[model samples]
Target: MNLKLEPGTLDDAAHLAELRALAMRPSLERVGRFDAERARQRLLQNFTAEYTRLIKQDGLLAGFLVLRPQDKDLLLDHFYLHPDFQQRGLGSATMELVLAEADTLGKIIHVGALRDSDANRFYLRHGFVLREVAEFDNYYLRYPQHVPLRGV
Candidate 1:
């Protein structure tokens, strides 16, 4: 199926609410009924003039990608395709857009995922180099790119 990555808008807040509810599952499983509302609030704080996007397949909110709009350096945050959409290459396409945009703008990007997350492996395979572990109780994994990856 074809995919679309379009800029997120205030209108998409409800979809975000829906996604955040699902997005919290892994964290909730780890932390037990974690406060996703709080997480959403915290996440929203990071939203700036950056051009965020709601990933769509056939015009549905299949997933989303948010990165710093101006910097070559970006934080790929809250990227999740629905459970039904997972394993369907939608996530990959979204990420490729992130990298393509980075490469176009001549910037590097960095992100941290949970150490045990499948996303960590995905990032590694996508040219994100493991740089360091992080602080905080959960001890996240840090991955970084200094430029468009050499081999693609």
Candidate 2:
């Protein structure tokens, strides 16, 4: 699919917000928390161009993800793919790429999936272990492994 990740810019925040809404709608709806305006606001409030990356497929914007550095690990946040891009292996491929980078740095990666979302299964399948389940999200952590994974 010629997937690529480009550095994000402040101007991309609005587009990323829309993408986030589209990607999280199904999961958010399942938990009665789908609010369009709120979603946009949240993305804007936390958007960090320095850490965000826009995902493109064959040169078209397809999704975005942010990996923020923590004291001893990395926080994987706001990972969203356009609805059309989901279930097509793009997300898994993206995760694998990030996981490889984390392993290379010998740092743990933390991620949170919304409750009742398919993301939970996706993260688990990728070797992320559950660390906690909050009211609205399930937190996970993947420790560094020197060996690379196959068939992600």
Candidate 3:
């Protein structure tokens, strides 16, 4: 499958908000925090075209990703794939790109997953180390892995 990350636009907010609601519903519901309106509003409030990307699979919109650069770290803020796209390796492939960007910038990556969400395992598998357990969320960090000089 051909995958690409295309820059997002302000006009894409509404559509993306709906996508976020759909993508997060299961985990949110599992935690008893499912509020479609709240999910959409939260995403809309922080939507940044500069940091957002529309994930395309074979020329169709499959999901969205939001990676923001903080002082010395990068935040994996919002990553959502359509229900149909889940468990299809697209998320992993998208993560590889995100991680590569973090590696290139030598920045630590931060992400949070809802308590009991499958995403927690996904993050851990991709080298994220659990650092904090909040009331409803689990935070993780991934430090950049630098290659050592052959002779030093």
Give all TM-scores, in the order shown. Answer: 0.76, 0.94, 0.95
1-152: candidate 2 lDDT, tens digit per residue? 68898999999999899889888889999989999999889999978999999999889898999999989999997799999888899999988899989999899999999989999999999999999999999999999997755697
Per-residue accuracy of model 3 over 1-152 as CA lDDT, tens digit each = 79999999999999999999999999999888999999999999988999999999999999999999888799999999999999999999999999888887889999999988999999999999999999999999999989455589
Better of 1 and 2 by lDDT: 2
lDDT at residue 96 of model 3 (Cα atoms): 93
Task: Output the lDDT of residue 3, model 3.
Answer: 97
lDDT of 1 by residue, 59-122 (tens): 8878776676334356665677777788888888778877776766666676766554577778
- For each candidate in the order shown, give its overall lDDT on alpha carbons: 0.66, 0.92, 0.94
Clashing pairs in 3: none
The positional error of residue 10 in candidate 2, measured at the CA in angstroms, is: 0.5
**Quality of model 1 by C-alpha lDDT:** 0.66
Q: In model 2, how large is the Cα lDDT of residue 105?
A: 89
